[model samples]
Target: MTELKQERAIRTRTRIIRAAAEEFDAHGFAGANVASIVERAGMTLGAMYFHFKSKEALAREVMNSQTEVIEPLLHSEGLQRLVDITLVWSYALRDDPLLRAGVRLAVEQGSFGLKDDSSFRRWERAMTECLEAAKKRGELLDEVEPALVAQFLVGACTGTQLDSQLSSGRSDLTERVVRMWRYLLPGIARRGAIAAIDLDPGRGRGA
Candidate 1:
């Protein structure tokens, strides 16, 4: 494709994804309508199909794109860095439609004929790496296993945000994640390291 055509195609695909994200966020994958997504994009069914083969494909795209919202914030490391990732991701879950829709679809996709776990695994791996770094730096307790801690942190963060979404539309998600870190820190980090860690809910935003 020529440059102009490629650019147009990119724009069209982005439009479709944004529209589909809105529909999925509101109705979830099982209830979302492909026609409604096309209409919301202000494009014809053919145009939507030209970009995405089906609703499943569109949903998968949204799920994959959720990481885009956090890839930039993942630049840091260590235990505190993991906290930053969770808090920033919580902020995205609250504010970014694409991410919120992607996470919802990722959780609900098994019913929609796609049972992908790549999104969750990516998050787990990132957390694991961060914890491993903290362990090497002597920041964690001697008995702490970085891998187990990573899984626990990922599960805790995911569960907290998911509950927050269902409870109050995620308005209190930051506080919940902060509380989670506070509750978890004593077991994972060395007593001396605890004093240096920042658990502020707004820490992610400042980064």
Candidate 2:
């Protein structure tokens, strides 16, 4: 009986989170309505409050859920791995409501008085690790700094994705990300490495 209760509880929480993501994605944090979220989840207000105490808590969970969409990129390393991450994220942003909500909330976090920047920092750390590996493998230019480039890459991706979102609802995000990499690689990659790196937006689909 206890096990069954726990499973049902988990399911209820998951449903509420999914519904919250949908609402938050469609409406910014300030605009999202808890009543509507409960309606979308097919749950009562008391049921949702049992899992998340407040709207801010729900928003934080939605933001954190963005990491759930990323699969482990075990087959590649260095520069290729870095590119794969961005391309995969572009596709994820288009397909996953949770990720889209998280990203939107992240950009508008300031409006809600949320100070968390962990998501952006996490991306920077991942990119920095990949760039460091690339530098060790002689794939990067001598002057390229892994940490600095990682920060720049994250900013570039943020801008490109926002532009894509506003222009076409991210229908062309992958192509835009490819263009972003094309513009960035020449400045950071080694002379011989630029031609060797695959810039195909579809490359991440298999990764």
TM-scores for the candidates: 0.84, 0.83
Please give the TM-score that candidate 2 achieves against the real structure.
0.83
Q: For residues 86-194, what per-residue lDDT tens digits would candidate 1 score against the true structure?
A: 8888887866789889888887777877878777777788788888889998999899887787777767776787889889988999999888878888988988888
TM-score of 1: 0.84
- The lDDT of each candidate is 0.83, 0.87
Best by TM-score: 1
Worst 10 residues of 1 by lDDT: 67-76
Please, what are the lDDT tens digits per residue for candidate 2 over residues 16-51? Answer: 999999999989899999999999999899999999
Candidate No. with top lDDT: 2
lDDT of model 2, residue 113 = 96
